[model samples]
Target: MDHMLRRQIEKIVPLTDSEFDHVLSFFVKKKYRKHQFVIQQGDPVNYEYFVVSGLLKSYILDESGKMYIMQFAMEDWWFSDYTAYLNGAVANSFADCLEDSELLGITKENKDKLCREMHKIEHFFRVKSNYGYVALQRRIFSLLCNDTQKKYNELFELYPSLFQRVPKALLAAYIGVSRETLSRLSISSGRKTQED
Candidate 1:
């Protein structure tokens, strides 16, 4: 599990064994079962989690209880309600395990301390933050401009594993389409529908 984190960080900056050991000291490992909530709406956000295994989805519910998934965090992905995590506020969204998962969580204080003490770690996080921002922008652009078919194709192109792992209904929701519409799109695109 620690190796997973080391690999992720090494993508941006290589770490010495001692450096990796120092970095690992700041995180707490946690496990969650499928469908368990990692962070709940209105709860104080304590830490941002790095996925070591399995999947999690972060989402919010509208007034009428329509769920809008904000992001999916899988192996090597980082996830938290940033607004709350950074500001010490209550969460406005919920993060739930989509599959039984293991994660390493770091509180803001620990993260700050780690960054202050390690230049390479700080640089790694900065790069990661930029990537996260770009991904968020791209998602927003797709949601605003792309038609259903395009959205489906883009999502499939970007995260093909999601098709196998996530429910069709959830995929439809993510693409802002109905399940029936997604099924049609799947068939037309030569992909298996959930029923198939």
Candidate 2:
């Protein structure tokens, strides 16, 4: 499992054998069933998760009890409540599995230790954060500028697996549309194809 995770990390940076071993040594395997909490509201997040398989989502519930999706992590994604992890404060967000999941967890303590022992590990995280930061920025722009039709196409185009793997309501939520609107969009797509 660590071998595969190491390979995933290698997509961004090459790790020497010694560095790989050092990084691998810190990972702890964790599993969760669908709907199981990986982190709960008001709980401190000690671990950052690297997803090997299955889907997990981080969201926050408003006082009215409506959930706002922050992110969805599937294979090869990393997620944690950074505010909770960095400050050692309680989390306002909750992370839960959407399907049975396999994850590699590394605690903030071990990560700090790794940063001290291995510079490459620190660099990898720095680089990874920049990528996630960029993605969040792009997502913000897409939400701000894209039309519903464009958003619908972009989702299918970018993450084809999402159509099959995630539920329709969740996809609708992510796209900032009602379920009926999404259903109509799907039908609209099919009609255009038929006309073509």
Candidate 3:
């Protein structure tokens, strides 16, 4: 688990053993069962989590009670309500475990302190935030211009593990397709794979 966090950080900046230990010391390890809520809507968002294992989904419930999946965080991913975490606002979305999950969490206070104390850590986080922003922009563009097939293909290409780990209905929701449409696409994909 420590290696996982270290590996992610090392991708952006190298950290000496003692530096890594100091960084890790600020995090709190936690485990949640499948279907448990890590961050509930309207609650205070205190911690941003790094997934050590398993999967989690962040989604919003509309006034009509429609659920739209915003994102999924699997192993080695970081997730939270960024607006809430950064601005000290309340969360408007829910983050829940899709499977039994282990996570490392850091409070906003500690995270800010770490960044202030370490230039490399600040750079690392800034790079991560930039990547997250780019991903969001791509997702927005895809939603605006892509057809269902294109969206599905792009999603599958980016996170193939989601196809196996997520349920068809939730996958359909993420792709903005009806369950029947997703089923048809799945069948088509299967036939294509078989022919190959």
Per model, state how many residue pairs clash.
0, 0, 0
Give candidate 3's TM-score: 0.95
CA lDDT of each prediction against the hidden true structure: 0.92, 0.83, 0.91
- Residues 120-193 of candidate 3 have per-residue lDDT tens digits of 99999999999999999999999999999889999989988788788888888888888889888988887222
Top lDDT prediction, candidate number = 1
The parts of candidate 1 lying over 4 Å away from their true place are 193-196
Q: Which model scores highest in TM-score?
A: 1
Q: Ten residues in a row with the worst lDDT in model 3?
A: 187-196
lDDT of 3: 0.91
Q: What lDDT is reached at residue 109 by model 1?
A: 99
Better of 1 and 3 by lDDT: 1
TM-score of 2: 0.90
Clashing pairs in 2: none
Candidate 1 residue pairs that clash: none
Q: Rank the candidates by lDDT, best first.
A: 1, 3, 2
How does each model score on TM-score? 0.97, 0.90, 0.95
**Could you give candidate 2's per-residue lDDT for residues 68-117 as a string of tens digits?**
77888999889999899888988989999988999999889999998888
